[model samples]
Target chain A: MQKDSQKTKLRPGQLSRPKNLNLFTIRLPINALVSILHRATGCVLFLILPVILLLLQFSLSSAQHYETVIAILHSPFIKLMLLGLAWAFFHHFFAGIRHLAMDVHWMTTLMKARYTSKVVLVLGVLATLVLAVKIWM
Target chain B: MLIELLTKRYPGMRAWLTQRLSALVMAVYSVFAVARFLIVQPNSYEAWVDFFQPLWWRIATLLFWISLCIHAWLGIRDVFKDYVPNPSVRDVLDKLLVVSLWVYLVWATWLLLG
Candidate 1:
């Protein structure tokens, strides 16, 4: 009976990756959305950390070095990167709050969960834009 | 009462509720700090100094540092809690996290205010 029930291992191409991320039917749920954003933001921050460390090392070297760091920050491309960092920071921050709220059972209802997730993304984007404008101007 | 509050009202479910809550608070202040910096772009050293001179800004910056310290503490504490389950070892590590947070807060305050 056990031998008959045993399944054969599949050969290559027996299973393939999905063609696309289907957002309509069988939608990926809100919790999964938040989880993916959290992981992605974490990865982005990890990549950005070395630049921050470099700034720290240079800033501590001397007043002239500090000025050079400030000048680099003032560059257009670097400004854009910082803008991305700002948004990433805020996006991760709000999503973290959403996670906390879920943990505390404040927004655990299905409707509330989905609605709050949307709100978090909207507010995060709004915040990033506002801060970027402020920094860039 | 405190234990009940943490167990029931804490943001995190299994552990690190305090840390998660601290991070949430820090996020709020961070948005404000960025906004404030944008309000006054302070191109010169004197201008930057003047920006920090406002009593309200000083208080807000103080709170911001406090929040950042708490958030860092929570993250580090969670690491210890997850990896070091031995009660005695965990307790020691937890105390160290708390201490480091205070130390960071003090250093930040000194730099910003003193």
Candidate 2:
């Protein structure tokens, strides 16, 4: 985010390089990609958490509400949505830990940042996989 | 222009620290809740209700709710602060967000108690 302007700035003679500004076509650095995913996941979790809480509340409130909630949970579509929520939670959790590490002056170097970003992404996905199994299997 | 506005207006290091601390709280609570789920097999409605009936668990959950609201506010506000450059609009939006979070927390407390 800090060097966003620097990224768009064109250097003299550097115009010879591909000016591919398309996000889909151009290659992005792994760390940059991780950063984008982190933000995206955060946004999803931010929007989804209230719904999750409401569902939990329903599950606990009354016998009828609990039955209805459990029936909804048994649906495959709801299961899929639950998996998505779990992935969002895991991604946000791992990427948040990475941010905390960066705050501590570690993983600030280019090499370390890239390596850590990869680790965060992998761990996030792994945690989600475990959750998916727990829910689906 | 929107990006620039969004990229600015962060409440700085204090908010950053708060987010981190609240995240820690939530993560720890997740572990505790998951472990209880595994051990107790709280699959039934009565079981789930019983699980949440304890005073200590209720207190821990209340703590988690507080942390969650704070974490959510700091996280969401971080993004909003960056994009909403107009102080008046930002302030209104921020207050609304906080109020909603607080309202949820109160609702959660009632759910736990009632």
Candidate 3:
């Protein structure tokens, strides 16, 4: 009776504090990591929109400005930076499509989900690489 | 009957559908944009302007931006609703975010039309 009464009080156990922050040691499944990366890239795209829009605004504001902006994008360093942005965009995009498929009940199984995630990652990387080659070489 | 009842009674069902529909539009646009970019490689000023000049492309871009705005607002509102404890404060924060997103959307529209 006392034990049951104590449980009714709703006292939970003490909280444990984690000491290590290392990520590499934990081997997360590919699908889990891919879902995480989707959210991460979504945040990146969300946070960077102001800058992207500002650049677009400048480019559209005037022809002279457009030339200058295009010149800036022509630089190797800027191309590399844009390449990273492209990868984030591509990865987020493909992963988002996979999510939509799941929403529509297309591939809700664990194995199928993981397989689609692998496909998303592969397509994103390949597209990014092709864009990089076209821009740089 | 059950499906209709479920769709009508369930909370946040409309928002969930909105997110998916917007995602569909955005996904299609993303693929088309990538292929167009890869083929044309609009690194020059003239090519860049040319890319935006086509009426069909402009309409597609406009639709994509509209979808993006709707998608983002619903997602952000959901996050604020989940995380923020104070109802009034969350309402204010939500309004602020909505205003900011609208500002960007209007700016993009102007860039497209003007």
Top TM-score model: 2
TM-score of 2: 0.81
RMSD of 2: 7.7
Candidate 2 residue-wise lDDT, A47-128, digit = tens: 7767867988988889899999999989999899888878887877788888878887987999999999889889988988
Rank all candidate structures by their DockQ, best first, as comma-separated numbers.
Answer: 3, 2, 1
Ordered list by lDDT, greatest first:
3, 2, 1
- DockQ of candidate 3 (2 decimals): 0.56
Best by DockQ: 3
Q: Who is ahead in DockQ, 1 or 3?
A: 3
Steric clash pairs (candidate 1):
none
- Candidate 2: tens digits of C-alpha lDDT, residues B37-106: 8899888889988988899999898898889889888877877878899999999989988888888888
- Once fitted onto the true fold, the runs of candidate 2 whose alpha carbons sit more than 4 angstroms away are A1-22, B1-11, B85-89
Give the least accurate 10-residue stretch of model 2 chain A, judged by summed lDDT. A10-19
> Which stretch of 10 consecutive residues in model 3 chain A shows the poorest summed lDDT?
A10-19
Candidate 1: tens digits of C-alpha lDDT, residues B5-96: 56756656524655665666667777687778778877664565576678777777677667666656555565566679899989987886
The local lDDT score (0 to 100) that residue B25 gets in candidate 1 is 67
Per-residue lDDT tens digits of candidate 3, residues B4-86? 64475765776787888898899889779978987988766778889889988988998999898898888777667768999
